[model samples]
Target chain A: MHELSLMEAVRDQALAAAHADGAIRITVISLRVGELAGVELEALRFAFPVAMAGTIAAGAELRIESEAAECHCTACDAPFPAPDGCCDCPRCGAISRQLLRGRDLRLLSLEVV
Target chain B: MCRDCACGEPAPDPAAVPASAPRELTLHTALLQRNDAGAAALRQRFAAAGVRAVNLLSSPGSGKTALLEALAQRLDPTRLAVIVGDLATDNDARRLQAAGVPAVQITTGQACHLEASMVAEGVHRLNHQGISLEQLELLVIENVGNLVCPGAYDLGESLRLVLLSTTEGEDKPLKYAPIFHGADLVLISKIDLAEAVGFDRAAAHAAIARVAPHAQVLEVSARSGAGLDALIEALGLALPAVR
Candidate 1:
């Protein structure tokens, strides 16, 4: 799964940052995974420990903040949270909804010591 | 004397060992921040050089290679160089080169899609070969032929071209709408065979429009060179220097 690859990158970056800060261990790694990012949280969690083996981030708890899928309705000119499996404009019932964020995968914070 | 011997045998202190070090360290960093940072840098580089990068995505046998070969032959070599990605072989790269343009082949091993890091590496290799980004007008990265996986990764491209060959049914966009939603331009390839295969071009365009309301669709046949000039002109307009 791509989650494994993503986890490998995450672990590498976390360890690098911890090492740079002269930290002996990492306790928590915080991340924001957007609802539309198409990443499965359980799969990511399952892959993290395996990817973290031998790294400073090993055994560190992963904190994920999932953002809801959102879109801007071109027809209604309104911003609303997009419903699951549908991009239709909620207010106007038009199918001209443009995505407005909520598809992002960002690492916002890391707790290291 | 027995009491004195018992008192002389002192019990060991249980708190002698220092407490174990803290088991947690607070790290607040986006896991993809590093890749995003790299991609941003690459975007700035492309902008500085006035190069427009287009990342192309489609399933296998979707005519991406054929489209590239045709584009390479049509565009002036003084301006265009293509970087192609595939799971194996440099066959596409070879074809592009034969069409009289410089081409670099990126073999992703077992990876399903091309990440920004891989594109960064490919750009660096191209630079090492004396092909300056400033000299090139367009950098087309034909992504590994998988619509689903490639939709998740951003390759720092200015435009995202999603190809849907007529051979593949008209409902592909509806089934894999994420790729269509991400596309800036949709190329309907293999239009020459549409009549023979009973492919409906209008229905295909309608499906794409439903998913990507604003994406511009261009129908072309790489084998017959029909509609190739218009595609080239569109590319020229998209990347002004290519004209």
Candidate 2:
């Protein structure tokens, strides 16, 4: 799965940050996955151990925060939450063509010691 | 006089002086930062070489190769080249070469998507095959046959085209909105079989518009060569003057 490679990216970044900070080890990795990022949390979890084995982030707690998908309605110029991948505007009866957020997959913070 | 082994340094505040305490470092960065950087570099290279690259994305059996074959046949093969990605096999590359164009095949093994690094490698292979990027006008990267993972990876293409076949159902766009949302052009492929497959054109158009209103949609059939000219024109591929 692509999630495995994503986890490897996370591991590489986290270890680098920890090393730069002169930290001995990483304890927790916090990530913010957007709803429309095309990433499955379960898949990320399944890939976590495989990607982190024998690394400084081994056995580290993985914390994920989800960002809700938002779309900008082209007709009404309003932003609304896109639940279930439906970008239909709640303010007006218009399908939103602009996506405001929700495609982000960010590594927010790292807990190191 | 200092307290707690502080040599006159205002007695190190106890509230903030925790020994061996874990530190939380904020690093707000995209997960695909490396890939994004790589893609950006590729874009600059393509611009420098004066080559327009287009990335094709679709599920398996979506006729991506067939559409490319038709386009290759129409365009000047000397100025056009293609890079095909598959889990295993050079079948697509062989097909495009047989159709009269320079082609490179990338066997990704188990990867479902083609990353920027892979595209760079494929470009190297294309060079080894006596095809130079500066001599090409259009370079197409046919991504692996998956609608999901490829959406997240940008291979430094000038345009992104996604194909949806008539047999795939009208709701396919809505079901896979992420990939469709990122498309610059959406091709409704296999139109010659639409009637045979009972494909609802109206519903498909509606679904595509609902999800990808910003994308220009075109109906095409590689088998009959219908709308291939429009597809070529939309991609800004100019035919040879003599042809």
Instruction: State which candidate has the highest lDDT.
Output: 2
* Model 1 lDDT tens row, A1-110: 47888888787877777777677778788778876675778999999889888876788888889888677877677887764424667677676646776677776667
lDDT of 1 by residue, B98-126 (tens): 88777889999998888888888888888
lDDT of 2 by residue, A51-81 (tens): 9899878999999999988888877867899
Candidate 2 per-residue lDDT, tens place, B1-243, comes to 577675766656655753457889999999999999999999999999999999999999989999988887788888989999999989999999999989999999999999999999989999999999999999999999998899999899999999999999888999888888788999999999999999999999988887776789999999999999899889987755665
Model 2 Cα shift for residue A34 (angstroms): 1.5
Q: Rate the local accuracy (lDDT) of all candidates.
A: 0.79, 0.90
Docking class of 1: acceptable
> How many steric overlaps does candidate 2 have?
0
Q: For each candidate, give its TM-score against the true structure.
A: 0.80, 0.92
Scoring only the A-chain of each prediction against the true A-chain gives TM-scores of: 0.88, 0.91
